[model samples]
Target chain A: MKNLKLIIQREYLSRVKKKSFIITTLITPLAIGLFIFVLGFILSYSDSEKKTIAVVDHSGIFNKPADLAKSGNTSFELVDATVEELKANFEDTNFDAILYIPEIKNLYAQSHTIFFYSEKSPSLDLEMVLSNRVKNKIRNFKIKELNLNQKELDALNTSVDLDPEPISDTAKDKSKHTNAVAAGLGGFMGFIMYLTVFIYGMMVLRSVMEEKTNRIVEVMISSVKPFELMLGKIIGVGGVGLTQLAVWAILIPIIQIIASMFWGIDTSDINQLSMDQAGIDQEDVMGEFSMIMSEIANQNWWSIIPLFLFYFLGGYLLYASMFAAVGSAIGDDMTEGQALTIPITIPVAIAFYIMIVTVQSPNSNLAIFSSIFPLFSPIVMPARLAFEPPIWQMILSIVVLIGTCLFFTWVAGRIYRIGILMYGKKASFKELFRWFFKQY
Target chain B: MNSILSVQQVSKHYGDYTAVNNISFELKPGQLFGLLGPNGAGKTSLIRMMTTITSIDEGSIFFNQEKINSDTPGLIGYMPEERGLYKKMKVGDQLLYLAQLKGLSKKDAKAKIQSWLDRFEINDWWNKEINELSKGMQQKIQFISTVVHEPKLLILDEPFSGLDPINTNLIKSEIFRLKEAGTTIIFSTHRMEQVEEICEEIMLVNKGRAILKGNLQEIRNQYKKNLYEITLDQSPADLSNLPGNIQEQVDNQIIIHLEDDAMSNEILSFFTKQGIRIRSFKEILPSLNEIFIQSVEEVEA
Candidate 1:
């Protein structure tokens, strides 16, 4: 136990003292800050400029000038002008586009005759906004011509937007539709989990390879048991990874806050963005944002954080042991490491790919299968946690993951005991298996 | 004399091929023991088993009559044939780390490492990375780490393979010094001259088995073929009738293998009887190199 501790200290300190580790730990948060800043800037700048359109409506359907559809970034002016005149004056005017409607008695006939002219191809946003407004007016006109009461039609429209109410006793929370936030956060967490596991596991693998190639492992094994040395390394490097993540977790938020303070990123801009996207007013957007903030504040972080750590450590050890085995098995070259690592890496890659499936359907069969599987659970289970999966599944996943880690660690240690001293020969699966079963 | 380590019929096999087959030997405390073997002769296997890098397959090993198990590794210092240290680690740090792994406390490791570096006259290289040092310098660091913990048993495989003459002598003196300080040393190598120079006891292994084992001088005497060299002041008119069969004749000297019934004194008297003035007479015991080759060949035959 003492030897394991010393070995862990050596492995951890040696890596943590590296210039690369220091540089990356300090630089990653800055990069993330820059990324968020750029993203926010882009979001605010999208569709900021207003465009005017001259509407020459020959159909006279939109006769009420006050009833014309207008938004903050788009406005329409009714003009009595021919298409030829409008086209000739299009470039000289401040108007961005000209919308022409030829003479028609009905909506079906107007569809073919309506023309929109612009200096360049029209933006999809502009096209969507104009077409939806025109369609709504036509629908209202058709209803009125049918002798339908407008208030009754509006009531029918209101009834179609049915919002289901939750039962008083069984429902966990007030929010029924948290899929949007869950998908975003869950996807982000799973991806980062996969990436960190992969990065740190590969570090352990390379570290073993370095020791073997350097021939230091012989000396090391003479002092400490191979299993002890390998376990120490896996835990030590995992600790380094966790430290980096912990630092990033703490630093990024602080950096983001500092950046927001220095750069004056107000919530109004975010509200404006939401308003533009949903075509809702500022008050509705403000209400939605607060509800989201409250939901975030009420999250069960105590459970979520420990679970995240469990998956992270479990997944890391599982892959790191396999990597260590490969490191022990391979000769001096990295080619064998690459080839062998593929088998270990595929499960992680598959787990990440299934994260999207988890987001789409949290209780999906594929999501449950992956979460239950030890290899994929380290990534999949945490993602499913965002949807508040049944407690049983979490327990099963954690238990299976821990069991798999223990099994692989033993197998890897067996191979390592012999492989570290083996030189000159390229390792084969047959030989590795023999080592696996060989008694010490 | 107290035997520090004893191997009782230990054997290791890989599939059908035996790596170290039923080989046994003993080392006295502070003995400079030589382990001589040809390529793939299982010297490395025995050394590894002794140092706990690999476990015994069919037998047991003991240190001070106590069975050598996992806990015995901390008492053994092993330097593998292929010298290895973390190349990116500083000399001082690497040594200290290895010493600690061998069960030295941090403070003791640091002090021992300092003393070792100073003894090697490499104190200035304490902060230099391993790759930045020359091969010989790196070897010095490797040697230091091996003994920095002051283990009871030290195993060095091909310790002087890549060292220059000066470094080799330096390592030799260090080995002698360690022996004087009561460290049982196992020196495994293909070099025979070194065995003669320092080894008090030796074992010759071939094909995973010990073929010869004894004190160095005793083994030499046991393998001796009664060969003698007689230096004459002048060439004899007739080169016949020497008591021994002539092996080679150089100017003013004759090398002969004495017949089983003949003696060195008889050869000298025969030379004097032939009126050839003898300048010097000497008996030549087979060198360890010659004995090793002969014994391996005999076993092979």
Candidate 2:
């Protein structure tokens, strides 16, 4: 234990103090900041409106209607001029181009020749408004000749419908309609964790492979056990990864705050809009949040946190130990190690992919089992936590994950003990299994 | 002197192929022992086992008569053939860390590393990253780190592989100085000349076994052919009755390779009869390189 601590300190400081490690830690965060900063600028700038349209009513037919243009991101101007006068002033570059609706004998025939021009293409909204204006002008003229009252016209423009709602515990937050959406987001985060572990865990493998291939591990194993060396390296590099994660965690929130300041998003407006758009109420968000939080708060966390930490840490160690062993087994050089990394990482990769597709249905036998299974638990458990799950199932999953860690730890250690001293020949799976089972 | 290390018939077998086959050797306190072999001769495997970097299959190793196992590996320093220090780590930092791993406290490690750097005239390199230094300089840093804890045994494998003459001498002197301070060394190299100059005892291994092992002088003598080079004012006369045959004739010397333990009187009498002034007469010893080649060849044949 004392020796292991010494090795850990050495591994941590040597790696953390390295110029490459420091440079990467600083560079990664800076890049993410630059990316977000640039992306925000582009999004806000691109959303501002471009060309404007001018409207003209020739037949006095649009006199008593609501104003056709709203002044928000878009602007519309009404031009009080006759067709001849507007056409004569066409050389003016102030307006992109003009829309002229000449007085017509047959509205439908004349409407076919509707004019819409701009310095470039006009907006779809502007064209729709222009067409609506022409329709109204002709309709009013027709109505004026028949002497139809405003009440009669109003009565003819409306329709009726009926809708009923179902009541449930999830109904309140369901109004905002994101509890299910929250499940989807949970799935997304699970996928991200899966991918992150896979990516950086392989980095652990490669680091082991590199040191082993170069025979550096031979010197290291002199004063340290193969297990200590493996633990120290995984933890040391794992600390580097955690440092990166902490930076991202801190930076992302800061970016979100900065972004929110520049682009204001009103909850009421978004909720109301979604409600009107989706025909669901906005208050369901409240019900859904409580449901999700209550579910999260009720988990068997004493069991899960330990199991999760075990699986999270143990899974990495188990795989990384085997990776280190494999690296040691490849005594030649780096090219063979590079070629071997793919197969070494395949198990972790499979766990990640399986965790991703199964997160939404965590209690779905697959996710639960994978969460309990040691090889997949590093990914599966975190993902399963996102959805509401039964306590016994969480316990079972956790038990399985713990068992998995213990099982693989021994297996990996056996391989590592034998593998760390081997050289000059590449080890295969069959031989490795043989080594693992070989008695002392 | 006390024995600092002992290897008793230790053999390392890898699946049926024995890397080190029953090679027994020991290093006494302050003794600089050399392990010689050609490429693939298992010198590294033996060193690895001695340093506890690799396990042995057939026998036990002892550190100061305490059987060496996991409990006592810290007492040995192993500088492998391959460069093991993290390249991107600063010299002082890496040295300190590795020293700490070898059981030194931070304060002591720092102090020791500083003095070593100063002694090597590489105080400026302390802050530089390992990768930033030239190979010789890196070797120096590695050497410093290897000895930082002042272990009971120090093992170096091809320690001069990439060094220039000046740097090589610097390292060589430091190694001698370490030995003078009572450190036992198991030095492994293919460079036989180094062994000839510094090593008192040597074990030459080939094909995974010890082909020759003894005092360096004795081993050299074992390969001796009693060859002699003599310079005379004129060719020695009475040649028809000389006991030993003259092998070759140079402008000023007669080269004789003796096949028997005969008295030089016969040769001396012939030289006197011819009235030749014998300028020089001496037997040349076999070089380690010649002995190594001949041994390998004899085994092959």
Candidate 3:
């Protein structure tokens, strides 16, 4: 036990004190902060871009139209010039594009050709604005020729909104309203968790390989038990990864505040404009934002945090041990290491893919099976938490994850003890199996 | 005195290949014992088994008259032939870490490490990374880490394989000092001169078995071939009919193997009777190297 402590101390201090460790730990959060700040800045900048258009209406339609004056990011000006004249003067007047509506000889006879000219590819929003105005005006004329009344037209233009809810009685009330934002957040968290486990698990693998290649394991084995050494290393490096993640989590909100200050962005103005465009009232948006925020604030972290930690650590330990065993089993070279780590890596990749699928269909039978399966549970369970699984399922998944982690640790310990000393021999499946059953 | 280490018919096998067959030897406290063998002759396997790095398939090893096991690591200082030390680790800190693992308190480990660094004249390298040092310099650190805990038994495999003459003498003197201070030492090497210099008892393992084992002086004496070398003042006239067969004759000296019933005096008297003056006469004892080769060949045959 004392030796295990010493081993853990050595492993932890040696890595934590590395220049690479400090640099990576600090750089990752700064990078993420920079990324989020840039994204927010771009969204607001593009939101404020407005364009003016010159429209030449030869069909005598929309010339004196009262309702088709200005839209959100687009406004029109009637130009009493030929297409050539308007094209030449559009750039001088800061007109983004010139829309030429050629005269229709017979309104019911054939289609009229319209052309839009610009110095560059027109923005999709600008195209949408012009096309919708022109299409509506033409349709109105077509309706008038048919002698349709305004009430019938209004009834024909009605739009329907959908509100999707889960059918489960337990979730009917809680999940009465589903939003894209919440689903996206759950998926993003799941992905970040997978990346953390992978990066740190590989760190454990590389450390073990280095010890073996340097021949340090021979000296170390004499001082401590193999199991103690492996456990110490896993815990030590895991702690470093955990520290990096914790710092990232804490620094994100601070970075958001700093970015808000630096950019001088007024969220209220952006929210008000968005609300006006969407025809939503201020109260409704505020209620949605506060509901989302409180849902986040009141998340049962007492349960979720522990479950996240359990899966996060359990998954890493399970994979890291096998990786260490592979490190010890393979010859001291990158090619052999790569070949051997493939088997271990495949499972992790499968689990991550299954996690993505689970985010889409949390209540699906496949998701349930994967979340309970030991190999996939670390990733799938955390993602499914937003869906709120049954208590029994959570307990079973946690138990299986912990159980598999412990079992693999023991098996890995056995392989590591024997393999650390074996060199120059390529370890085949048969050979590895023999090692597993070999008495120490 | 009680034996510090006793191995009785210990064996280790991997699959069908037996690395160390039924080998047995014992050494009393304060004795420097040499474990001699050629390459692939199981010297390292035997050492590994004794250190508990490898499991014994048959029989057992006792330290201080008690069976050795996992807990015996703290009592043994093992320097494997592979010469392993964390290359990126600083000398002082690495030594302290290894010593602490061997059951020394941090304070004790620090003090011991300091004194060892001072003794090795490497005080300036205390904070230098191991890879920054030359091979021989790193070797000195490895040796220090091995003995820093002042273990009761020191097992050194190829301790002098990479050392210069100066460093070799330094380590040899330390071995003598440790033995004098009542620490049992197992020195494994194929080199015979150093083994003969320090080892009070020795075992020659061949084909994973101990081919010859006894006190160093006794083994040499037992392998003596009744051979003698003598220098004469004048050349003897054709020693064909001499009392013993001449192995070689060079310059004024002749090497002869006496007949089983004959003695060295008989040859000396025969030369004297021939009106020749006897300048030097001495019996030649076989070296450990010679016995090692002959025994290995015999076992192979």
Report the C-alpha lDDT of model 1 over A183-292, residue by residue, as the tens digit. Answer: 76788889988898889999998999899988888878888888999999999999999899999999999998987787777546766775766767778667777877
Clashing pairs in 3: none
Clashes of each: 0, 11, 0
lDDT against the true structure, per candidate, is: 0.84, 0.70, 0.82
Ordered by lDDT, highest first, the candidates read: 1, 3, 2
Task: DockQ for every model, please.
Answer: 0.67, 0.51, 0.68
Tens-digit per-residue lDDT, A1-440, candidate 3: 99888888888889889898888877877786677666656555543557677787887677565634877666778878888886666556777777888776665754656789877777665666666667667778767766878787788875555666558867644423343434555577678778977898888888888888887887888888878888999988888888778887887777767766776655565677556545567996788788677667655668777778888899889888988788778748778678778887787889889888888888899899999999888888888887678999998988988889999999998888888888788876667778888976
Poorest stretch of ten by lDDT in candidate 3 chain A:
A173-182
lDDT of 2 by residue, A28-96 (tens): 666765666566454334225544456565555555535545433544556887556766776773555
RMSD in Å for all candidates: 3.9, 5.5, 4.0
* TM-score to native of every candidate shown: 0.88, 0.81, 0.88
Tell me the TM-score for chain B of model 1: 0.92
- Second chain of candidate 3: TM-score? 0.91
DockQ score for candidate 3: 0.68
C-alpha positional error of residue A175 in candidate 1 after TM-score superposition, expressed in Å: 2.0
Of the two candidates 1 and 2, the one with more favorable TM-score, higher being better, is: 1
